[model samples]
Each structure stands twice: as C-alpha cells, then as structure tokens.
Target: MATQTANALRFLSMDTVQAANSGHPGAPMGMADIADVLWREFLRHNPKNPKFANRDRF
Candidate 1:
C-alpha cells in the first residue's frame, strides 16, 4: 500500500510537470516515498476541512 501510494504520488507529480511543460520532476519523484509514509503515519489534517484550526499544518 505504501509503495503504491508513493508511486501514485510520483506519477501525479510527473504528470503535472509534463502538463505544464516546465518545472523539475526529480524532487517530487524522490520525495514521494517519504511523503507517503509521513502522511500515512505521522501527519494529521482534515481532508474535508484543510484549514481547520486544530489541524496540524504540515
């Protein structure tokens, strides 16, 4: 699941760069796994209310 999540992030990041025809893709690709693990295990925020006062701000 974690690997899948990481790959999905990488793909989306790459796609965004490709669509824009600009920006560096290496950072996103490299950070994908770390971001996935952090989000899954450590980060806490509300998807429905991203700016909630009590939510962790990354």
Candidate 2:
C-alpha cells in the first residue's frame, strides 16, 4: 500500500511539473510522505466519500 502511494506520488509530481513547466518537482517528489501525512491525516475529509460536496479535495 505504502509503495503504491509512493510510486503514484512520484508520477504525480513529475506530471504536475511537466504540465506547469515551472517550479521544483524534486522537493515535493522527495517529501511525498510529509505531503501524504498532511493531506491524509491533518486535512479534513469525509472518509466514506471524499468526493462529497462538503469535503475538502486537497
């Protein structure tokens, strides 16, 4: 599970930087765990259905 998330994060970071054509993807790419924790833990959401209108997407 953790490995899958890590790989997904790498692809996401790379894609985002590639799309924007600016900023540093490397930093976020390296700090995926911290990003994951902040988003998956501290951030608010509806666990049952995160896509629900009232929930924050990220």
Best by lDDT: 1
Residue pairs whose backbone atoms clash in candidate 1: none
The deviation in Å at residue 53 for candidate 1 is 2.8
Candidate 1 stretches with Cα past 4 Å from truth are 48-51
RMSD (CA, Å), candidate 2 to true, equals 3.0
Can you tell me which runs of candidate 2 are displaced by over 4 Å?
A: 37-44, 49-58
- Evaluated at residue 26, the lDDT of candidate 1 is 100
Candidate 2 residue pairs that clash: none
TM-scores for the candidates: 0.82, 0.60
Clashes of each: 0, 0
TM-score of 2: 0.60
**Predicted candidate 1 versus true structure: per-residue lDDT over 4-30, tens digit per residue:** 999999999999999999999999999
